[model samples]
Every structure is written in C-alpha cells, then in structure tokens.
Target: MDARRQGIVEVAARLLRERGAAAVTIRAVAQEAGMQAPTIYRFFEDKDALLDAVAEHVFATYVAGKAQSAGDLDPVADLRAGWHTHVGFGLANGALFALLSDPARTRPSPAAEAGAAVLRARVHRVAAAGRLRVPEALAVELIRAAGTGVVLTLLDTPPEDRDPALAEEMLEAVLRTILHDAAPVPRDDATALAVAFRAVVPTLPTLTPGERSLLTEWLSR
Candidate 1:
C-alpha cells in the first residue's frame, strides 16, 4: 500500500480505538487523514471495505506480536501463555474484537483464521506429546468457544464488577476437559491413546498414503 492508503487505514484504526466502529465513517476517516472523502473512496470502495481493512490492520499487529513471542516453554505451558495473550488482546481491543467476531457472520476473517492456526499448532503439540484427551479439532473448538465467551462476557460487564479470575478459571475448566494430567503411555485409556496416535499418523514411517488415511480414519472414529 502507498503512504496515503496506509495513512487512511491507520487513521481509521485510531478512530476505532478511540471511539468504536461507528466513528469510522469515510468522512470521519477523510477528516482524520487530512484527505477528502473521495480520496478514501479511491482506496476503499465502500464503508464495509474500509472497516474491514481497519479491522485487519489493527488485529494483524496483535497477532504478529503473539506469533513472535512463541518460545521454548513446554507445549502445555506455552498453550497457557497463548490463552492469556488471547484474552488480553480481546479485552484491550473491544471494538476491533467485536467487529471481527460479528455474531451473524457465516465465516471467519483471514486474520481470525491466522489466529486459529496458532491455536491449532499448540493443540497439535499437546497431542504429539500424548497429553491431549480429545481430537485436535475438538480441543481447538473447546478453547476457542470458551475463550471468546469469557472475553465477550467480561467486556460486557462493568470493569468494577468484572471477575478478575474468570478468564483463567474458564481456561482451566476447558483444559481439564481436553487434556490428560500427564502424557499417558500405553495406558488403559483408549481415547487418549487414539488421540495421541492420530497426532503422529501423518508422519508414520513407510505407510502408503492410503494406509495412513485408513489408520487415521479408524483412530479418529
């Protein structure tokens, strides 16, 4: 993007941060960017385009920072770190989160998909370590559903009345449902073994593609 287009997006994101999405009109963005309304039109076909760009611009920065901070901690510990980061980002960016989360939306944004990819990576590690109790996709959904609800509920509450421990409490509850207390090895639990086996099926040595697919099909069931 040119300096002018980037400037317009930055100004619109600033408006969202300061005054929420309703303040991000083309005329308002133009006034803030020191350009005319037609200039914003040249960069964005309509209000929805401009607001979507603003949402991407603001969220991609937070997602980039989270991606960069991934480190050498234990996978489970790292997963907890990710949960805290996600909750913090949601609380700190209520308007952008609201816009990105659009309750009526049929699909997720590219930016949201990027964030979900990060969570899936984390769950994959836990499964690879033989600690995941559910299928990887199911674990991802559990965390995501709980995390979004926790953040949105907290955001809807007055800060003075909000429960400081709600986010962590909910994370623990979801983790308990989806993870084993330790990596169970050849234990009596068929489900955990199947989940862990499914995690490694993609890399199983010397199996034909069909064989791998067939094995995974049974394990996933």
Candidate 2:
C-alpha cells in the first residue's frame, strides 16, 4: 500500500479505537492523518469503505502473524493452537476483542472475510483429517463463535466466581457443545483446552464505542 493509503487506514483505526465507529468520519480521519478528505477518497470509497479497511487491517495483521507461526500437522493441535491464540489475543486486547464482537461490526469487511476464509480452510482441513462429520461453514462459525463467547463470558464473570476450576468447566462446556458427538474424543484434550479453562479469564468491563476507540489509539501506539 502507498504511504498515504496506509496513513488513512492507521488514522481511521486510531479514531475508531478512540472515538468509536460513529466518530470515524472521512474528514476526521483525513485531519488526523494530516491529509485532505479527497486524499482519503483516493484510497477509500467512503466512510464505510474506510471502516472496512481498518477492520481488515487489524484482522489481517492477526491472521498473517498466526499463519507464519502455525504448523500444519496434527489437526487437533492446530485447532487448539488456533483457539488458544484467538482467546489469548482477545483477552489481552480487550478493546479490540470487544470491537470485534460488536453486533454492529459483526458483518466482516472484505478483508476480514478473507481472513475468515483462512480460518475456514483450517477448519476444513481438521474435519477432513479427522473424518469429522462437521460442515465446513458450521465448524468455522462455531469455532469463531465459541472462542468469542468464551472471551465474553470470561470478561463478564465476577471476580469471586473466577475460580480456576469454574473457568475450566465453562471452557469445557463450550467445546462439548460443538464436539459433542466426536467418537473416541480424548478426555485429556478436553481438560487441557484453553478456551474451556476459567482460571485466567479476562473479565473485561462493559465496553462502549469510546472505550474501543481508545483501544484503537492504544494499539496504534
């Protein structure tokens, strides 16, 4: 990408993180990026277009980084690793995670959809290798949803209820819902699952668009 285009995306991302999506106007982004609104138009079709680009920018960074680090062997291990990364990243980046789970932003941008395609491919690979009866789309959706749910739940739990055992139980329950029919499923795998465990859950506060926007600024920095 050109410097100007990248600048627009970065500025938009920061604004979204600091001001919520509602505050991320093209003119505002242009001003933040030290460019004219027309200059932003050179890279984006409109404000919606720019929002999508920002979403893609964040999501692609994650997907690319994971791809570089992931090993293709052991479908189950790959699945676990992917889940671990998802949950870990979400918890660690509470603001970004909340932004991602926002119902308003749920419709992924083209870039985010492309990243999701990569996730779908991995799901298919695991299902094929295991000869699991899961539909590719359903598996992909379930995996993503389950991971998000786990993070959200953790973020919602009371401090007193954050016992390690409780966290483990919650994560296991989530996986059981999806892998309920898997024959010869290993109990150890279920027990060792990261998303299923409760001890280190995130427990983020209720977030607003402003908080998420702040996260964007923090992330950009």
**Backbone atom clashes (below 3 Å) for every candidate:** 0, 11
Candidate 2: which stretches are off by over 4 Å? Answer: 69-71, 92-100, 105-107, 131-133, 153-171, 178-221
lDDT of 1 by residue, 1-221 (tens): 89999999999999999999889999999998888999888988988888778777877877787677565678799899999999999999998888888776555677888888888888888898899988999999999999889999999999899999999899999999998887664499899999999999999899999999999999999
- State how far residue 21 of model 2 sits from its true place (Å): 3.0
lDDT for model 2: 0.62
* Clash count (model 1, backbone only): 0
Per-model C-alpha RMSD: 1.7, 15.7
TM-score, one value per model: 0.93, 0.65
lDDT by residue (71-162, candidate 2, tens digit) is 55565566666777776666555555676577875366675566567666566555444333434456667777767777887767764675
User: After TM-score superposition, what is the CA distance of residue 36 in candidate 2 from its true location, in Å?
Assistant: 2.6
**lDDT of all predictions:** 0.88, 0.62
- Highest-lDDT candidate: 1
